[model samples]
Target: MMPNRVIAIGDFDGVHRGHQQILLQLNEWAASLHAEPMVLSFDANTKGQKIITDNRVKDWYFSQYGIEHWQVLHFEQWKEMAAEDFTDHFLKEELQVVGLVCGQDFHFGKDRKGNEFTLISRGITVKKLKSLMVEDLRVSSSMIRTYLEAGELEQAEARLGHPFCLMGEVCRGKGLARQYGQPTVNIPLSSRQLLPPYGVYAAWVEAEGSRYPAAANIGVRPTVESGGEPNLEAHILRDSPDLYGCEIRIELKAYLRKETRFESREQLFAQIQKDGEHSLTRLEMLK
Candidate 1:
């Protein structure tokens, strides 16, 4: 016979701290009933535009949280199903979920007609996680995304329970920054992912368990030349080692300013010196 399962359901776009709490509760409930923990989430790629995180990031986050069993249900069929039918089919027949955990604002089923009350009436144990408040505001993925787009890294980090991070592998670049004495490790932009505003930022870069204070640039390299693909380039402070072909994670700590172009190479170098000085100051403050 299949093992009993305590199921948690959500889109979990960014899987922020509030979602972490709900997952913890689901784990606890599963342990109490000797059941396995399962996450019922939608398949990102299969859903196209509505999908949130790419599969790689989502899998990494869930795996880090010790979630071994994930049921990636297709949203197309269930999108129009009624609450009663969803409960009867996926919840009751397919998963045989004994306990459920979700955020207080979560809704399910056709027209989003499902609620905590409905789940309780169906005889399933239910736990409603309260919204996490940070600095008198509700912590949410949308709020974090807003901060990211606005280049408010510090505010976004507080709500995220950690720094906002972008993970990618170092790739080849035109090495234009080298001409200005500001060499950069370039990361290609992805259409499926949301990036912080085009700016210079104070960031902590992690590679192979090592972290370094660095300055990051996210844009189309307007200073060097315009009409190029967007890229993320990090210049590690006081350290210039080979990082080509290495996967790195950049955790943004604070926003410095938007990318700007200068009239001449000499002027650009001067501004870079200033950006470096400001980045160092911000790093010291973070420490």
Candidate 2:
């Protein structure tokens, strides 16, 4: 039997504080009504803005908040759906949604003609939340992206209510860093994922449920190889199990220095040693 759900719907790009507020309310309502808490989100690619968090991390947030289900609607299939048909056919008959929670500015249906009123008219209960504000400014994914593009991690974190991170599977890379005794894991980046300025950072890596301080670089390894695309590489400060094929999350804590093209691999290794030390110190301070 399908469990009736009370859902919060939005893009929830970063699952920032504003989204968190709605999620909390969703849980409360679901508990009171004896229904499951679910989230209805759209794929990041469907939106105009570059994604702040990928599906993996966004789903992780839903799980953390005790949401039972996270549904990603296929934008192409649903874009032409009418407002009344959406509420009556999809939300009512299909998902068995008992209630809905959305932001005050939420819109839906073809041409964004649907709104909270549209749902209410269909006999669906709706809760709309106001935007979260930080220091007289609205906290939004765009503001967080702007902070990241400028390498303002603290500002981004303030809006996100957590550190901005890159979460993905570790991929095999040229073993050049290991040859220098500083082994690193490469995390392939998606073009749609918004990135900060190309640089080295003091980072925290979560692998196998353990968090380790790390020195991370985000850019093409100009001295070693040539690639137009940017990448993320992190060397854990402490010894750990191999991470290849494992999903890991690297949180940028502090920007250390800009990525530089050293004349020699030896020069790069020397600077990396310094970076590792600095990152270790920074992580300790953050604690």
Candidate 3:
């Protein structure tokens, strides 16, 4: 028999404060119903935009909030399913879901037809949560994305209720930074991840249980190479171990400057030194 669950459903991208409300409610409903608390989210938004939160980040959010189970519905396969069929087959029969919680704006199934009313009509207990607001503005993943794209890290982090972070495995870059005696750990940008504006940012990079202040650049290395895919590389401000192959999380604290090209390698490294010190000062101010 399928395990009984009380599920909260949404794209849950970024798992912002608004999403937290639904999760918190799900816990309450599950306790009363004697069912497991779970979250059911799609792999992407219905509109198929780049994802704000990747799997590692989502795992961190869920774990921190005591969410026990997470199920991902592939958007491409589930998008066209009829509303009634989705409720009967997917929610009831497959997942054995006894209760549902979602934001008031939540919609599901073909052409976005399903809603809290639909769940009630189908005999499922439903909780429709109101949208979370900050400073009279709705806190949403889309709004956070806009803030990030505009290089407004402070605004985005305010809504997220946590730092806006980039999580990925450290990869070997072209060794140019090391050649200049300014080593950095590089993380390749995923095509599916929504990125902040290409620029230098004062950041905190977490790796192997330690956090270091860093100067992070997110963009093509215009000064070194003609053209390449954008990648994130951070120079640790203090002495650090080799981080290649380790999974790391870079939490953006503040934007420092836009990316620029310099005429010579000496000029580029000199600017990098200045940026590193500036980042240290900015991070200290944030504290």
Candidate 4:
């Protein structure tokens, strides 16, 4: 049977805390009206422009929040539809949507000619969400990206309601850390994936349902040699169990510092010591 009502649409790019608020509202409204809460998102490859989060990662986050009935629609054809036509088609023919929930800055249709007023005028109920403020600043996906690019993981997590994460299968590397008595797990990054600024960070490493506190580095290892491939390597704290060939998720908790080349191995070791201490302290505070 067709649900009598549906909460319509939004970009939902990162699915950060601000986006969560809108989803929660939709869930509440849907329950009150005995309707289904639907999330209309975009497939990363199909989106007209670049986005901050990939489709898989966005879907993971949404699933974590218990959102079902998710729809990842292609944006290319939708972008060509006129504002009114797009709304008429999606609301009436496709979804039979009775209401819509979206951020105040939401825009849609060709040239983004549609607004909350336009939807309401079409006899569709619309809820325009006010900007969500966190820590005296507006919480947004762009702001989160800025913080990540600047190596401000803590600040980004504050806005995201969780640590910034990278997911990939473990791969073999030069094994330099192992030679130096600190074996690590390395993950190769694809070009389309967003990387935190080159630096060390405090992180939580998760694989197959278990999580561990760890010290991680994201950079070209300038100390060993110059012009090498950039890599992400994490040294799981005090644990020596095998993780080779496993898929792992790394949650960046706090930025330690920018990648630096030291004059001697002794100096580099001393800096790593400081980073380890800082990582433990930050992880404790987060707990």
Candidate 5:
């Protein structure tokens, strides 16, 4: 007999609302069959390619939604693996997956040969879900990425069912915010991750199980360093937890303004103060 499982296989890039739908159905099936909900996903990000969700954050979200078994397939190792080997060796022998779920557009294996029929041929049960629609738009990762690239945050968030977030370690900064006395956690943007436009945003920064409203800047310090890696600086309203070297997750709740170079430090400081107040007001509305 096959080991009990309801395996949902896909890139599941964003785990957007549509992806959640498949996972939710898998949950119901797993509960009914007394099986576990398992997810098999890729951990690769192509160069110059943007994704709605980065792999690190995606992994955490998967666990939060009750996925018991998580299998991350390294892109380099399995990129050339055949569909036959994938089923016989990986799924059958390795995972012992008895049931499968995926979107209608799901494709996998070498040369993108695997499909719904491929899994069925291996004698595994398969469920192919249709893409979900929201606001007359097909809720999809690619669509959401487009919205983010264009800085249409609210539209992207609507399809995502959550705010667009950036996750990184709070690195040491050049001590600009300290001059004003409130601590700002600086997060370096990874080249592997997708970025919204360089701008100021009303955000929520989460650290060590607590979330704080913040005014954040997503850009290199154009005023200070003419050229620098893209960095995200979030000034948590009324809280500073010695976040240096700490990992923090900042969700872009709303876009506030485009990043601009000020003629002087005084101008920048004044604008940041206004941004902090506006960010607080926006966050209050979220509550």
Candidate 6:
């Protein structure tokens, strides 16, 4: 028998709560129909925004959710296909997709006209998961972005199904922490993705499969240095550790304070100590 499939399609930048709901329903539908459960997405990001998550992370997430078939169409090419053509050639001929799944707000095709109705009108079985509502707000990537911007770490994590993370190699830094404070693993945020506001945060630093609670800061350091670009600095609450040149992932857990200038070096050091203690307390609740 030809193996039919249920294709869940979306940008899925953060794979937020609503995406999780749709994927779960896709699994149920696929299982009942004895078909494959798949996710089809594009290698594109929303304009004027840094994504909360990216492709590599999504690949692992899909496997963890018991989904093995993942298809990524490039934005430039896929964007040109007409609504009817995508349903016919890609959905019907290539994927053998008997069932379709997407959020209620989903749109596709050359000019973003393919919606839930487009699939239904084409004799395809479709499931339009109702827009997820939480505290009277919609569950969406944009909502998660707002949570991050507002320094609402728990809310952001709850929506994304995981902590908002910054992953990069630990770059070298000048001796700001060498004399007055603790050494930190400096992770560059650059212009790569969207992030929380410039501030100190409660965090977790992961390296080589180990997780350590940490206090982190993200900003272009104004008080400590000059002409600094945006970056992430995580001071692992335990040992500062030998991390330069190594890669690590930091999870922002909660906001502690906004980035600020200090009157003196001693004053800056003292404030970081207080922020560290407060961050540790907040991170302790996570454990």
CA shift at 242, candidate 6, in angstroms?
Answer: 3.5
Q: How well does candidate 1 match the true structure in TM-score terms?
A: 0.85
Instruction: Tell me how many clashing residue pairs each candidate has.
Output: 0, 0, 0, 0, 0, 1
Candidate 2 residues lying further than 4 Å off, grouped into runs, are: none
| Model 5 worst lDDT window (10 residues) | 44-53
TM-scores for all candidates? 0.85, 0.97, 0.96, 0.84, 0.94, 0.85
Q: Which stretches of candidate 4 lie over 4 Å from their true place?
A: 2-5, 44-51, 223-229, 262-274
RMSD (Å) of each candidate, 1 decimal? 3.1, 1.2, 1.4, 3.1, 2.0, 2.8
User: For model 1, how does the per-residue alpha-carbon lDDT over 66-110 read when each residue is reduced to its tens digit?
Assistant: 889887777786788898888877787878877889887878887
lDDT of the structure predicted as candidate 2: 0.89
Candidate 5 Cα deviation (angstroms), residue 286: 4.3
Best-performing candidate as measured by TM-score? 2
**Shift in Å, residue 55, candidate 6:** 2.5
Q: After best superposition, candidate 6 residue 37: deviation in angstroms? A: 2.5
Q: What is the lDDT of residue 183 in candidate 5?
A: 68
Q: Go through the candidates in order and give each one's C-alpha lDDT.
A: 0.78, 0.89, 0.89, 0.79, 0.83, 0.83
Q: Rank the candidates by TM-score, best first.
A: 2, 3, 5, 6, 1, 4
Q: For residue 32, give model 5's deviation from the true position in Å.
A: 2.2
Per-residue accuracy of model 3 over 119-193 as CA lDDT, tens digit each: 889989887878889999999989998998888999999999888898989998888889889999999888898
How many Å off is the CA of 156 in candidate 2?
0.4
